[model samples]
Each structure stands twice: as C-alpha cells, then as structure tokens.
Target: MKLPYALAKRFVAGESLDQAVPKVADLNEHGIKVTLDLLGENVKDRKTADDTLQHYIELLEGIHAQNIDSSISIKLTMLGLDIDRDYCRNNLFELLDAAVKFNQFIRIDMEGTDYTQATIDLYKEAFKKYGKHVGIVIQAYLHRTKNDIADLAELGADVRLCKGAYNEPERLALQNMDAIREAYKEYLKVLLDKTVYPRIATHDNKLISWVKEYTQEKGIGKSRFEFQMLYGMRLNTCKALAAEGYNVRVYVPYGTMWFPYFTRRLKERKENIWFVLSTMFQK
Candidate 1:
C-alpha cells in the first residue's frame, strides 16, 4: 500500500484505536464532540464482516472504558451489506446492543447511490428497535434525498446531512452547484423543522453562515442541532462554534483499512489536495 502518511496523519487519527484516543481527547478538550468512524467498507466475505462487527463492539467497549465523549459512525457494507442484507442487519443489531449497553450513539454513514436505499432500509429496521441510539446520514446532491429527508423528518430521525462525496451521474444527482445548494436550503428547513437534532455537515463558509442565520430566525436553540465537520478540516471553526455555545461535532475516522476513506477525503474537497501539498512542502 502506497500510504500517503502525511495526508493520513492529517485526516485519519491512526491505523489503530490506540492511536485515536488522544486525537479524540484533544477534540473533547476543545469542547467539540466526536463521531468516530472506523474506516473500512464493502466487505465481500462473512468472516471479515463478522470481524468488523466484533471490532465495533470492541471499539464501543474501549471508548466507554476510556470515558471518551464520542459516538461512532458505521458503514453497513463494513458489516456485510454488500454480502447479504439480513446478515448486515443482524450485525448492526448486535452492534446496537453494544451501543445500548454503553448508552452511546451510532450514526450510519451513507455511501454511494447504489447503496442508498438498502442503507436506509436497514437503518429504519435498526431505528425501530434501537431508535434512541442510532442515526443515519443523507446526501444533498441526490434527487431522492428530498423524499429521504421527508421520511426521516416524519420519523423524527437524527440525521447528518452532507453535500455528498460520491461521483454520481448527472441524471441521478444535481450536477450544478446552484441546484445542489438550493436543494440543501429546502432540505435544511425540513431537517430543522421536523428532525430530531440533525447534524449539518459542511465546510462551506456561506452554508455555515446561512445555517446560523436560518436557525436563529426560526428560533432554534444552538443546542437543537449540531454543525459537523471532518476531523482535520476546520478546527478553528469548530472551536469558534463551540465557544459560541453551538453544538459542534467532528467526524474522526481511523483504521488500518483507511485508504478508501483517505482517497474519498482528498476527492471531496479541492482544499484537501492543497492541504496535502502545502503541508508536504512545509515539512
């Protein structure tokens, strides 16, 4: 593996849980919460998926034992969604049992368009049983996300809304920036109006400012929802929001199978490329 150790250090906590603890603690010290995502997905076999399930249970135990103020994010494929839906769901339920035990929360991370509906289906199934401790993410670029958000709103689901990271086709996703942002505006209203403590995930300054203004105009308290950003992208903004008494959470990802997540990070933002190059030269 051609590990871009520099970028990995920037975006991922580490390749192991032992290396992630301090990172999480530092964010907590700064008054920001965390949602730890163990970076692995699209598992093709049962043993690996089963191992993933077990590792998550261990992760929960470890976080609880360390007294970490962090929740976790899960990708269903990591738990075998691509292999079998029922098997994946069973794994999710088992992990939710651990979440219940520790009184921690788990947010299901949304993948590409192909996995969207099945992800939601499994999430709803999990929510029906362990709704209090489970949540899901939705992408703003997709045309179907409007309906997805409506369903989540009705369910009063705790959702994380992002502008999407997948390279979706034009027919299925909003290709123009203006169209995507407009869709985000409508989605935000529904999320704030009906969802339970939605997390708005974006690094766009205008969108961030707009969310502050929109929520304020609607009389929504700062504690009503959260502003979520990737772990290494916006520490200053996260701290500023925290200082302002707004709920802010950082999505901290770490694991040995981190290459996929790492590449996704670089592709998600042009700034990430510059971030890597700038930091590389600095070193």
Candidate 2:
C-alpha cells in the first residue's frame, strides 16, 4: 500500500530537490544548518546509480548557487557499491569532485552491518583523495565501532557518531538499549579526543546533557564539535542547541523513494507510528 503523502511529509521534505531547498532555507533562517539526503538506496542498476550521481551533483550545484548553509549526505548503495567497487568509487569521486568544486561537504552514510567494512574502505579511499570536504558516519551500536573510530581518528577524519537505527543479529550489534547508549558515550569520548570535529547525532536528553557536560569538562568549546538531529524528530531541541551557540545540522531527507526510510523511522519510535495512525483517522 502506498503511504499517504501527508503522513510521509512529516519526515521527508518532498519528492524533488526544488521542493526541498526552500525547507533548507527555512531551517537556516531559524539558525540551523542542513544536510540534504536524496531518499533512494540500494540501487541494483548502473543507470539508476548514474542518475543518482547526477542528481547529487545538481543538488550540490543548487546549494552553492543559492548560498545555502548546508551540506549533503549519501548512501553508497545508491551509488552502486553493490554493483562494483571500482564503479562505486568512481561515482563517489564524481560527487566529491563536485563538492570540492562548490566548496561544500559530503557525508557518506553507513548502512547495515553487511556494508560496514566496505563502506569504511570506500570512505577512507574517498577521504584520502578528496581531503577535508568528505566525511563518514559511524554507528555506535556496532561492536566494532570503537576500533573503527580509532582508525578514523588516527587519520584525523571527519566523523558523525549515531546510535544506529538498523536491526541486526546479536552477534554483530548490541541488542540492549543501555549497552548501545553506553557504547555511544565511549565512542564519543574517543572521537572527541582524537577527531577534529565529531558530529554527535542523538535525540536522548540524557545523552545530550552528558555531551554538553563532557565537552565542557574537557575544555572543548562548542565550535570543536556539532549536534545533529533528524529533520522533523526534535525541532525544538535542535533549535535550543542552536540558540545555545552550538552548531546544529538538521538531516533532511527527500525523494520519491521514501517508504523504506519512513517505515524504519516509524519502527524506531512508537510515537511516530501512533502519530500516523492518529492522523489517518482525524476528522
């Protein structure tokens, strides 16, 4: 069944880049930075991958031309990572090249456990070639995150740490909420100590408070790191952080392929599911 456009719009910006930029501008007007993500993933064909690449390039061009204070995030599978490593790398290089040309940034988003290692390898290769304009995300729920963070830290790579959203087997991912939260804290400490600018992305108030206290104790000013939240999840919290003078970036996802992303988000938060059901039955 197709999801109602109104229901999905709570999370997705719209079906096209043109519809999305005004949203980015609105967030920027509220003193929040933006990270635009095209909502397709796991492309199985080269044509789709190539099209995704061009869309990203055009998105970057629009961002630069409009003078929007925003960056972009992309999934490797959308760029043909599953098709061929070399092909995927070349596609990424094109996007990174465009980002460099525009003096902007691109973040390689991490997917499931299966793609973790390959994604990291691609990110390292891209970062080595593209330099400061490229970055990657790390999921704290993964048992290997500490070591991965250490490796990225040694390279002085840009990192965004999130308490992952995917469901995984017990063998590969932490199943306990407390365990994931603790891992998030430890991973963040390592990131703050070694990485130049780590993005802390979470909605937990305890974690948010802890990050503030921890950074203050370590004498890390607000500028050394940033706080990130999804586009529609916690607008007030994001606004509050921005008001407190911390760099806050809103992760805004948009595209016609939004069902998978929307369903995953609904599973992550029961309240969101309830909101949809409630809205569906509204007068």
Candidate 3:
C-alpha cells in the first residue's frame, strides 16, 4: 500500500524544489543553516542518473540565485554508482563544476556498506579539485571507518560523523549500541584533532553533552566544528544549540521520491511513529 503524502510531510520538506524553498528560508531565518537533498537513490539506468545530475545543477543554481545560505548533499547511488563507475564520476564532475560556479559546498552522503569504498574513492578524487567545496560522510558503526577517518585526516578533509542509519551484518558493522557509541567517541576525537573542520551529526543527548564538555576541556573552539541533525528531528534541541552560539545545520530533503526515506525512518524506532503523529500539520 502507498503511504499518504501528508504522513511523509512530517519528515520531508516537500515534493519539489519550489515547495522546499520556504522551508529552507524558514530554517535559515531561525539561524540554522540548511543542506538540501534531492531524495532519490539507486538509479538503475543512465537516464535517471542524468536527470538527477541536472536536478543538482539547478539546485546549486537556485541557491546562488536566491542567495540562500544552504549547501547540498548527494548520494552516489542516486548518481548511478551502481550502473557504472565512470558514468557516476562524470555525473559528479558535472555537479562539482556547477558547485564551483555557484560557490556552494556539496557533501557526498555515504550509503550501504557495499558503496563505502567507492564513495570514499570518488570523494578523494573530487577533493583534489573542489577542496573544501566538497565534504564526505563517515559512519562510526563500520569497522573500517576508523582507518578511513585516519586517511581522511591526512588530507585535512572536512568530515561529518554520524552513527549511521543503515542496517548491516555483524561482519561489517557494530551490532551493539554501546559499541557504536564508543566507536563514535573515538572517531570524534580523531576528527577534532586532525580534520580541517569536523561536523558532529547526532541526536543522542548524552553524546551531545559529552561533545560540549569534551571540547571545552580540550580547548576546541566552537568555530572549529559544527553540529548537524536531520530536519524535524530534535528541533528544540537544534534551536537550543544554535542559541548557545554553535553552528547547527539541518539536512532537508525534498522530492517526490520520499517513500524509501520515509519508510526507513519510521521503521527505525517505535518512538519515531509517535513523533510523526505528533507533527501532523507542523511547518
């Protein structure tokens, strides 16, 4: 059965870029930076991938045109990473070219375990030219991510650290929440120590508190790193953090292809279901 758009609206910005504008503006008005995500993934053909590439070009154009203080995030699968690597790279290059013209930052979003290495390889290639205009995400649950973090640190890459949302086998990812948290702490320390700028992305209250205290003790200034969260999740907390003068950005995805994202999010936790019901008509 198909889910109603209304139910999904609680999480998604809207079904099109035009609809997403006000939401982006509203978040910016509240002093929260926004990162726009076009929201389709795993294209099996060239046409879809090509179309997805154009969408981002236009997104970058719109951001520059409107003078919106927002960045963008793109998933490899959405750009045909599965269909063809060369094709995917070319598509990414086109988007990066546009980002250069518009002076916008593009974040390469990490997907499943299968896409990890390829994603990192592509990001490294892009970083050579785009530099800080391009950023990469690292999931702490993965066994390889610590090593990945070390390598990225060498480049002084800007990195975003998250607990990861994908479900992977025990062979690849940490199955226990405690293990993942411990790994996240270790990853955070490396990121703060080495990366040019680290983005701490999490909704866990304990982790948030720890980061705040740890940074103070270690003498890491607020401008050296920023906190990131998904749009609509922990809004109050995001505001509170921003009010405290820390940079906070929200990942706001808008598109007609929201089913996959919507289902995965609601199924992630029982609390998310009530959370959705509570935000039925919220802006």
Candidate 4:
C-alpha cells in the first residue's frame, strides 16, 4: 500500500536523497543542525545489503559535495548484520572509512533489544578505530542502560541518549511512563558528567526544562552538548532552543522503506494516530 503523503510528511523527509538534500539546506538555513538517515533495514540478502552500503557512501559524498551541515545515521541490519556478522562489520568499516575521509560523522542507530548487544559491540570496535568521528545511541527505558552508559563513558564515546520505542517485556524495560521519565533524567545526568559530547534526544517539555536547569547548575557550556529531536515533531521548541543559543540538531530520516519508522512515530503519540486516521477518512 502507498503511504499517504500528507501523513508521511510529518515524519519522513521524502523518498530519496535528491528529495532530502533541499530539506537539509532549509533546516541549516534556520540555524539547526541535521543528521540525515537513509531509511531502511533488515535486508534478506547480501546483494541488497551491499547496495545499502553503496547508497551510504554516496550519501556521505553528497553531504560533502553539497557542503551541507549534517551527519548520517546507519542501521546494522541495513548493512548486513542479519545476513552475516563479518559482513556487517566490513560494511560498517567501509562507511566509517568514507566518513573519516570526508571529515563527516556517522551515528550508529539502535534497533530492538535483540540487536542491542551486537549494535553496541559494533559501535565499540568502530569507535576504537575511527575515534571521534562516530557516535552511538542508548535507550533510557532499557534496564541495562546505566551500565551501558558507564561502559561507553569510560571510552569517552560520543553518545545520543533517547527513550526507546520498541515493544519489549517489562522484565527487560521500564514500562511505566513516570518510571521511564525518571530513568531518562538519571541517564541524562550520567551522560553529562561522564561524556564530553552527549546528544539528548527527546520531545518531553519536562525533560527539556530539566536539561536546561541541570546544565546551568553544572555550568556546562552550550557547545559541550547538543539537543536532538525528530525532523517534524517539535519544530517550534527546537527552534526556540536554538534561538536561545543552544546547539540543536534534528534527526532527518528519508527513503522509500519507511513503514517501520512511520508506524513507530505514530505509536508514540495518540494525537498522531488520530490525525492520520482522520485525514485518511476525510480523504
């Protein structure tokens, strides 16, 4: 089925990099940084996986050639993690190599709990080799995050802290909203104290206020960290924060395979569901 263009516009940038670069330029013009994601994952064959790697290389080249102020995010499964571990590692290294040469950055995006450990492992190996040009994300809702943050912090890794979106059993994640919020607070503090450059990715006003207050109390400079949000969810808030002289980066995802990402964004807020459903019925 075709995705409704009106509904998809709120979350996805477009269906290809050609369509995405202009959007990136617009955001940059607004004084907000960006991370371009080529939306795809879970490939079933080596040929498709190799194609994903080539697309990423071209993406890096595109960013550099266009002089766009943005980084790129990649998923392991899209790069062959499911097909073969060794193949996945090689693919990651290939992207990292290109990123390093282009003087660009790559963010290793987290997936479900099943891929969590392997993703972290891949991040570690890549970081050890590529150094500061790469970063990884940690989900605050997971029970294992504190320890994970501690480990990554010791390596002085660049980390993006976000509340997870995947569905998992309570035994593995914090299910309650309040509990998750509190966990996010604690994780933010740890990231601030330990890591040099942590990206706080959230749309919650409470969390956003807390981050501001905590940074002020700690006397952390605005340049030391960044605030990250999705491409369309909190545009006003992101702009306000950027106006206040805070470094704000938007996660701009684009591509043809957008079902999983679009559905996940809709599930995060009931209003989003109602909006999409209402629009569909009205159409």
Model number with the top lDDT: 2
Candidate 1 residues lying further than 4 Å off, grouped into runs, are none
lDDT of 1 by residue, 1-283 (tens): 5866666778989888999999999999999999999999899999999999999999999999999899999999999999998889889999999999999999999999999999999889889999889999999999998899998899988889998988999889998887888898899899999876889999888899999999889899998999999988889999999999999999999988888887898887788888877878874
Query: Candidate 1 — which pairs collide?
Result: none
Q: Estimate each model's TM-score.
A: 0.97, 0.97, 0.97, 0.96
Judge candidate 4 at residue 27 and give its lDDT: 87
Q: Write candidate 2's Cα lDDT for 1-283 as tens digits.
A: 8867778888899988889889999999989999999998899999999999999999998888888888999999999988999999999999998988999899999999889999999999988898899999999999899899989989999999999989898888899989999999998999899888999999999999999999999899999999999977899999899999999999999999999999889999999988777767776
Relative to the true structure, how large is the alpha-carbon lDDT of every model?
0.90, 0.92, 0.91, 0.91
How many angstroms is residue 4 displaced in model 2 relative to the true structure, after the best TM-score fit? 2.7
Give the worst 10-residue stretch by lDDT in candidate 2.
274-283
Off by over 4 Å in 2: 281-283
On a 0 to 1 TM-score scale, where does candidate 4 land against the true structure?
0.96
Off by over 4 Å in 4: 277-283
